[model samples]
Target chain A: METFKHLVNILAHPTIMLTVGMLVFLFFFPPNDWFEKWNRRLRLNFLWTKKGFYFVMFLMVVFFLFGLTDPNFSLIIKKPDNVPIIGLIFFVFIFLWISMNQALKNDNLIEAGEKPEEYNDPEDKVLVWPDLVYIEFIALILCMSLLLIWSIGLEAPLEGPANPAESPNPSKAPWYFLGLQEMLVYFDPWLAGVVFPSLIILGLMAIPYLDTNPEGAGYYSYKQRRLAIPIYLFGWMILWVALIVIGTFLRGPNWNFFGPFEFWDLHKLVPLTNINLSEIIYIKWFNRGLPENILVREIFGFLIVFGYFLLLPPLLAKTAFKKLHQNLGNFKFGFFIFLLLCMLSLPIKMYLRWLFNLKYLIAIPEFFFNI
Target chain B: MSDKKKSNIFQRLGESQVWKSIIRSGIPRTRRQRMMSVLNSVFLHLHPVRLPRHAVKVKFTWCMGGLTFFLFLVLTITGILLMFYYRPTVEYAYTDMIDLGEQVPLGIMREIHRWGAHAMVITVWLHMFRVFMTGSYKPPREFNWVVGVILLTLTLLLSFTGYLLPWDQLAIWAVTVGSNMARATPFLGHEGPGAALLALGDINFVNIGSDVKFALLGGRFVGEAALLRFYVLHCIGLPFIVMILMAIHFWRIRKDGGISGPT
Candidate 1:
């Protein structure tokens, strides 16, 4: 029993004496350059590639450092109070163990002279890391640091412990969702969440279909490329930006981006008149002939606004499609017109509500439970 | 003659639609070919004939997105394990959460599930942004881009739905506000034009007048009904949809020539 206990201690102790011993022995011993030799024989460089291999190793070491420093055992241990130094140590060993295994596999492959195709550069293409990588990496690092400081240390004060009964006024969703939420404040719920999101999905899906020129595949797909599609997408993006700005800047006291902008209350921001553009388009044009007029009017407000926003894009898309066929002379012309129509329509849709007192378009919370 | 009579497995596999071409060729020529031919039969279908090797190389993958997927898988595993002990009833839900924190064997599982969810969201978003920035959403792979966007939405929805399962005050009201926000959805939302049509006799047919709150709760408001509805959506419905979409997304990757970017 004492002997077993000592063995266990040796195996599991912080020093990890036995494991390190095995690792050291494995790292140094049995120098098999067989794979390297095989590569030489085949002119393959099977276990070669100097910079790539080094970069991979650097990555492994970085991962190791992260494991050591942060030690993500909080999920397993539930001790958010203190960092798990022991878990970090164990994780490091585990990572090292995996690395060792990978190394051994590489060594064995070298010995067997088994060269994978990746070992041979097909084009001998000059591989350069794009300049954007560093910029993105820096941005990422900044964002991560901000989040860590906010969540872990003293940046934003943690709102007092979870209070179930009282929801903080204008209780916001996460920032990214703020854009979507802001859209909701303006439009109907379905349009904000489902239709708009769905349209975004469909738009993304349509990218392949719209941008057919293969020349724009790898790089420089952005320049003077087909007019309509980019315009449509860009317009969509602009709307999102506008919504985010409105969500953050222009919204009333309740869901305002910066706490309580007292320029106007919810009432003014919510245009509650009869003549919003979206309403006119929907009530007059889209739902023109539907009988049961009285029954429809109650929901007509919702229907007109919803139908115009929902259906107008496709109708305009059809017009764009028709123009694509009729005026084959200039693809860009058709595309730009389609984009213009969509661009004009949505803002007009938004403008009608904002300027013309289309408060009915703003689906109040009561509508949620009533429906 | 022997020198000229070469049979490199790597070369052959490296060759065009290697497995498909082999299968179409009737029989394997040798032992190595046979082994590879079998692997090619099963796994090759999951990928394209040739994946422009450097394209998917780790440098391009950036490991961050992959790490996020890894964490998601971990979260799924640990979440399932925790679910075995967690009862999603309003009364027991919060208690289960606390219990998991205090009593669950590893307790790390719960923490992992929690933190992993957060990490997965951040990673997936970054993945989308990376794809966008690289112009990876361009043609041939456009549909896949859409799939990715859907996947991102599903991830957010999953996180939102899961938020309520903790059954804490934060979960209840946050979701209340969130769903209320959903209630304002432009086209389909009840508050928009759709609400009147969705109702009948002062009872919402959509929710039987329950609305999204009622529909979500199986009652008029956020109570036990809401908890159960969110539980099912989070655990079963959304995940199922996501998994199906994810399968389609991955398969499309191979079909669309594997991560279109700077070659």
Candidate 2:
């Protein structure tokens, strides 16, 4: 009795009460039934009721119990709107579920020819604290409810209808898309807004399938590997640098593609608008007699594409497997690397544009950086 | 007793002209029954039957993702309401937004739409990152992951298309950059080397070669036609597609079974 009292006193400190409550609930109700059902159906279980959810609740209550006792917690009121109505409906459903489940537990005990107290037996059960379990569940649901209401209420009402003529400076995308918009300044718009972004989406989506060897499916795959580590690090480093560089530089009039707008009175050096590409190509030995700039690019592009798509894949496959053809060849590692390269293409292209701008400035002193 | 109940129901259904009119929509009896079953049962309608709720339990987390979807639904409802007063033309687009903000009855609806969109993106990304951290993208669940990726792309596309509907200078220039980027895409692109390749003598022929510039702008760059196209995509085409994808995504979640990891 003294030990139990001491334990209760320690938990009552409020600094540890939430944690204590969480531990009690987890120790008692493990959500074993949920896991069993999940595993039976999917051959795996990830929804463990013992971790995180209860833990977060425990930490908050233990750490912030003082705050809750203060006036601030009271400020978290339910908003008066359709959101609250939906919340009310959810609350009702939760209550009904809890009541029915409790009743059903009692019914099962009775049907088994056991006393009602058996369901609540303290001696026979090692960690079966139903009260604690119920408390944790309710607390977690309340937290979610509070979060939903808070989200809805935080949104400010519209200031006015949209107007076109009075274009605001630093016209921004919604905060969510600001990251992508920031990329456009340094990159070719296609690279920033489309290709790289597309690759990221594709990469995320392909993760489950690309690594789907059914080996280490649920566990971290790259943790033990050193070979892929550098690549991942490099990819992330490049991404951050690209985002910061583009967002910071290459902004202002014309939404310039590199480090702000710079003067380039190139009409004096080379009359470009009416000039035929064939004349320039004929003058150059490397791209001799090409009718258009595209013709030269295409010729080189074909070589690179052919080598990459046709020759290299087969050569690598033959070297790795000692066989040219195989039914189960996925080239997962190669594809991963290829995807990474695709992701980096935007930043690289953006860099090239920056380089060109610098060269142009150097070539003609009059075409100096504006900033 | 059951026979009498069935007979009465059949007779009532037969006598109702509305039921006959519904049948003329070419809905087979089985399909009608299924839809009616969904509409009739409150709880069952929360989820469709074809979903293998049991199977997807292991490789899916139902909590945050579900919340995000709920938010998306809220945004859709509010967005549709705001669309009633929105004008996408450059001349009146910004004015419409101002009007929505200052005038229109319950103009707060427009604020909700804008804010909802911002919130939706945050939630969706959080959902995606959660899926990644949990290693939810493993075998048998790969296709669903692909679908999720497509959904992500569509989400961004929806954001981009919707951004231009305001028809302000910001909308105009931002979309100009965005569409120009689209035109630079290989094969079906309107610019870069691809455009020249598509040209045969004076006529540039192919999917994106001929009239590509005209089609995108509706006339020239960032004009009235562009705004209308963006408006339709934002309010109509993108939403419809997103809703369908969302439905499929949810169904797939159940089919794939819930979140992956150990208990």
Q: Best candidate per lDDT, number? A: 1
DockQ of structure 2: 0.17
Q: Kindly report which residue stretches of model 1 are placed more than 4 angstroms away from their true locations once superposed.
A: A1-165, A224-253, A257-371, B1-65, B102-111, B133-139, B181-213, B261-263
Model 2 vs. true fold: TM:
0.54
lDDT of candidate model 1 versus the reference: 0.51
User: Can you tell me the CAPRI class of model 1?
Assistant: incorrect
lDDT of 1 by residue, A1-371 (tens): 34643453345321243235333322222123543344346543222245444555677566444433432311212323112222323333333233233334444554576532234354443212222233345545654454344343321112333455677655655433556776654555565665666666565555555545443343222222334323433443345433443443333346532211122334435333455333465566787643344334446555764576566545655674554444443454344344344344445555554455554443334344211
Candidate 2 deviant stretches above 4 angstroms? A1-205, A213-334, A346-371, B1-62, B88-92, B104-106, B206-213
**Candidate 2 lDDT tens digits, B1-263:** 23455556665675468965654322224545545544445544444433222213322332446556656766678787877887666677777777766687645665455555645554565455445534556665677777777777787778778767765555665566556655655434554334445667977664443445556667546677777887888888888888888778877765776334321
lDDT of 1 by residue, B153-226 (tens): 88988888887777765566667767765445432445544566655688655533544544565765567877
RMSD to true structure for each model, in Å: 19.3, 16.4
TM match of model 1 to true structure? 0.54
DockQ of each: 0.17, 0.17
